[model samples]
Target: MTGLRERKRARTHAAISEAAIALFLERGFDEVSVAQVAEAAEVSKRTLFAYFPAKEDLVVHRFADHETEAARVVLARPPDAGPLAALRDHFLDGLRRRDPITGLNDVPEILALTRMVVEAPALRTRMIRFQEASERALAEALQDTAGVPALTARLAATQVVGVHWLLSMDNSRALLGGQSADERCPAAVADAGHAFALLSEGLAAHL
Candidate 1:
């Protein structure tokens, strides 16, 4: 069946990603070869490439869903919900759930990956590029939902996404500094709530 085939593909993809992360954490992102990852996952290099096109994708693939998620939230917002309010609610919900995007899911392996990215110039650049793409996707969604000017949508998306990036960096720093998830998550959630509130105040007042 198509569904069964898809599930098998999904499992293979996850196995490759998990193996890639493990090797990257152990040997540094820049030092780990695609062939090495394929071997670790027990898949051929071609198969790995079929799943993730580039080396950067091995780590950043986790973020690919964000673009779709942003659009989906905006498109499905309650009739009375303004764009800013909808995004605020969405982010708050994620924070309460301690989602990784909020920097609350501070697993040791994730922290190691963060350190690897921080130390690698190429990875850092790729992350910035990914964030820009996510912002553009979110901006387009906001523009469609609110019928706002392009600039307004862009500015709003930048503000919200920038806050999220900062929060993720803060959480990574806390974890790298030896803070446990249990110790860091509540504080990160509270801090993110305050940050979103500040953004909401300005966003609601302006556009």
Candidate 2:
């Protein structure tokens, strides 16, 4: 029963969010009001608030998907897998798959979503908060796995997330410049290799 209720709740949440994103994309994020989103989703204004605390959340909800991803990657890695290796491999896989979160995807809707977040001040700020949370989680995971001091774990997490953030932004900017995925992918892959190499002091070192 608990699982069923949670699934129903998730569906409602997604319905409201999908409606909100469609409306925001149609108009602009600043132009859309919570009341209008409620009407579009057929939920009460109060109900909408139950799912998303701020208007910014309606658009950036997807950021929550990755909030603990780095931590999970560290925790679940094979015994021989080093922390940095696990994270780098995960990010490289995301790039190969052209995951939207990696900013390597060139899909039209994804590109538009990237532009929306990049151009909107509120969304960008919210994204920074998400990145900070990811760093914290990664740091905690590193402390547990490596028996490192908290500060050292934190510094390592910062470097890892910083590399990821910069790569994502670079890819987003490339798409924003009107470059097609085909035109940008080869360079993006090569750049990701260089970025990860620098962090791990060369991919060979991580190996």
Over the stretch 1-207, how does candidate 2's per-residue lDDT look in tens digits? 999999999999999999998888888887889999999999999999999999998977777888899899999999998888888889888888888888888888888888889988989999888889999999999989877788878888888888889998998899889887768788878888888778777333322
C-alpha-based local distance difference test score of model 2 = 0.86
Could you tell me which 10 consecutive residues in candidate 2 have the lowest summed lDDT?
Answer: 198-207
lDDT of 1 by residue, 1-207 (tens): 999999999999999999999898888888989999999999999999999998999988877777556667888999987776777688768766767766666666666777887788888888888888878988898888788889988998888788878987888788778887679877877887798789878888654
What is the TM-score of each predicted model, taking all chains together? 0.85, 0.92
- lDDT, candidates in the order shown: 0.82, 0.86
What is the Cα-based lDDT of residue 180 in candidate 2? 75
For candidate 1, give the lDDT: 0.82
Residue 123 error for model 1, in Å? 2.1
Q: How many residue-pair clashes does candidate 1 contain?
A: 0
